[model samples]
Target: MELADRVQSLTPSSTLAITSKAKALKDEGHDVIGLGAGEPDFNTPSYILDAAKEAMDHGQTKYTPSGGLVPLKNAIRGKFERDQNLSYTNSEIIVTTGAKHALYTLFQVLLNRGDEVIVPVPYWVSYPEQIKLAEGQPVYVKASEENSFKITPEQLEDSITSYTKAVIINSPSNPTGVLYTKEELQALGEVALKNNIFIVSDEIYEKLIYGQQSHQSIATISDDLKDITIIINGVSKSHAMTGWRIGYAAGNENIIKAMTNLASHATSNPTSIAQYAAIAAYSHDENEIEQMKLAFEERLNKLYNWITSIPNVSCVKPDGAFYLFPNFKNVVNHSSFDSVDEWVKQLLEEEKVAVVPGSGFGSEDNIRLSYATSLDNLEEAAKRIKRFVEKHSK
Candidate 1:
């Protein structure tokens, strides 16, 4: 049987592909150090797990409201007010299975056939595919490395078109780990307001920042922007609850209601137990979250220095998130490999260090290595990468 055109046109996620390849190699008895993982390696904090247990013991196994439970919504609302200085009513929030699901649902509800969503370069891999799945086009604005992998207001203005419906802003971005400053977001918000388009702010990595860098929600810039912005976030990265699949979106009540309706037919509610766990995640003391951030910061500092110390590799120090995206153009140019993909393949095969090639994230000159694992694993991976670059350097 023939697949739908949408399925045929979709590209498999290269991040998952590389990760699976690494797992296969490990299963074959090779000591593979897989660094492509997007989730934190840490376990869910005990308090959140305890909450799940309590919910289960109370027979909270049935389906909830299609959007989310009232308690979970209240917790999410409180989180936004406390962290972002933004307030939302229960009608304005819809909790989906994950942030990714929230995004997919948003596209399905917000876009019409041939609508365009502006996506910046070095974006999270799923953004473009999710837009396309909604019969929308993804217009990419190249965020050059010199700009710290961020697009400017002028670039945003240039990318908008008659068909443009939304612009995605993934701060503390995946793959690149770059955060947008508050002022930067304000300027971009102006462009969105001027163009009468929506701003889809993916703040899933909001709590993962290091040092003085801060995560700012674009929706908090002003009432106008908030009216047009959809805030996508969850407990996946923040609370190390990737498997729990509790993510939510806050925005116009109409859109949230539509998304909830769509989800009602698709997956019903998010897992009942997971919703209860997320309530605890949002309500509990944040000490565990801070500890996780400190651990990642330490790993990032060591691994960033180690990678930059190598001969032919260069990377911008990430402000947040757990990944290091380092440019390997020099290494690729000097080696027998014709592309970053080939270089990544050979490195995984020979050195047993798995990394997602930058081509998958809309840039072909770099590769992403996550520091979410232990420092020992990062150190070992760095050693292997350093050797690989040295052997291939011109």
Candidate 2:
């Protein structure tokens, strides 16, 4: 039998593929430094682990409500209020399996056949795919590197049509690590409001910012903007709970209800013990988050400098997240590679340093190198990348 048409349209994730390949190489005893991972390298904090243990000891391991544990929802509600002074009732919240799933569920519920979601270029690799899986059309809006990889309000307005249902905004965006300033978001939010398009704000990397960069939630711009915005976030990145698989979406009551209903048939619920741990994650002090952020900032600074030092490599200094997306078009041209993907593969094979090509993120000329690993690994990886560039330079 033929597979479903949607299955045929789907593209397997390139980020995970590269990371998996690097792991296989390492397992074969090859010295491999994989920079394709999107999670924090830190372990979940002791408080959160203790909470999970307590929940299990208290027999809280059973399934939760299809939405999530009531306490976890309350904690998530409190988090938004604390972080952005943004209020979201439990009815407007749905804890999900992960931030990725939150986006998936949001699209599933929000889109219908031929509905369009405007995705900025250099997006998280999954945005377009998730939209497509929801039977929605993904209209790509290129956010050029010259513009600091941010889509202008004019670009957003130009992309919208009657079929446009929503536009995704990933502040401290993955791959590029660029943060949208408050002013920039205000402009975009105004356009979104004017165009009557939902704003899917992915703030998964909110807590992992670098020097002088603050996270701005488009929802917090105004009550109107807040009403039309869906915030996707989770403990995976912020609390280093990637293994725990806890995330959430907060927005309009109707949309949240729809997402909760879909999640019931889909995931049943997020893990109950993980929900308990997330309560601790949200209620606790910010100490653990600070330390992780500092580590990433250090690595980002060092790696950014190291990678940019290579001949013909140029990078935009990012304000948030743990990635350095360097434009290697010049390097690729100088090194005689036909494409960025070819250069990435050659670097991995010849130098055993695996970095994700930017092709998957909608920028064919750039590549994303994650610094979410140890200083030693990152430093060595940078050295390998530099050497690879030098060796391949014509």
Candidate 3:
């Protein structure tokens, strides 16, 4: 049987691949310390779980409006207004299975064949694949590790072509965990506005900042930018609700309506029970979010310190999110490995410590390590990694 060309060209997600491999090793009785898992280690807060149970008990397990329940939309609307000072009507929002699904569907509705989306390198693994799946071209613009793995407005401006349709902005990004500052977003928003390109802001990690850092939504920069920008976010990371799979896009009403219509023919609607649970997530007390953020910040600090202690390994301290992207090229070369990908495989096989190869994220010299696990597990993983470095350097 032949697979479609779109499906054939797609690569397996490195984070999930590494995580599956680690799970396999563990199932085989190895003491694998997997740092590739992207979701928070914490259980979804009890309140949200209770909400789900209550929803099920109340017979709320049927299909919802294709766009989302109005109350859920109101909850989401209140969230944006409270958190980012951005407002959108029910007609301007579409909730999907997850933030990942929202991106996939948005591209399906936004792209024509041969249209281009400017995707910064070291991106979340799915961006390029999703664009290609929609018959759109993904124009990669490298975001240098030196600039904390962020791209500049000049770079974005230089990448635009007549076929360019939209540019992705993933702040507190998946692989890098770096936040774009307000001034930075303003400049980039200006470029997008000037070029008449839409901005797709993926802010799933918006609530997970550390230290003095803050998350900024590019849509909140101005009304014009908001008009052209689509905000992608959900309860997955912020509320430890990854499995619930409730995410949404807020933007132009036309785009939202099109996505809703497309979804009606596709999913019918996001899970009804999950929609009610997500309403509780946005409606009720959010103290659990702060608690998870504090735990992640602590783990990030310790893991970042431990990983950076290795000889020839360096990392930029992330402003938010739970991942540390450390450059190990010098370490790889010094350890006699030909490539970072091979080094990552050997490290997993030999030391049983799993981290994602950055090649999958478009960087051949780095690896992504998630700190969304217990401090005990992280400490052991770091020790094993340090031991691997020393052993290989010998």
Question: Candidates' lDDT values, in order?
Answer: 0.94, 0.92, 0.93
Q: Which runs of model 2 end up more than 4 angstroms from their true locations?
A: none
Error of 3 at 104 (Å): 0.5
Clashes of each: 1, 0, 0
Name the regions of candidate 1 deviating beyond 4 angstroms: none
What TM-score, computed on C-alpha atoms, does each candidate reach? 0.99, 0.99, 0.99
CA RMSD of all predictions? 0.7, 0.8, 0.8
Model 3 alpha-carbon drift over 4 Å, by segment:
none
lDDT of 3 by residue, 179-205 (tens): 999999999999999999999999999
* lDDT tens readout by residue for model 2, 1-394: 9999998999889999999999999999999999999888888999999999999999997878999989999999899989999998899999999989999999999999999999999989999999999999999999988999999999999989999999999998988989998899999999988888899999998998878768889888899999999999999998999999999999999999999999999999999999999999999999989988889888988998898888899999898888899999999898788999999999999999999999999899999998989999988998999898889899
Candidate 1 lDDT over 164-228, as tens digits, reads 99999998899899999989999999999999999999999999999988888999889999999
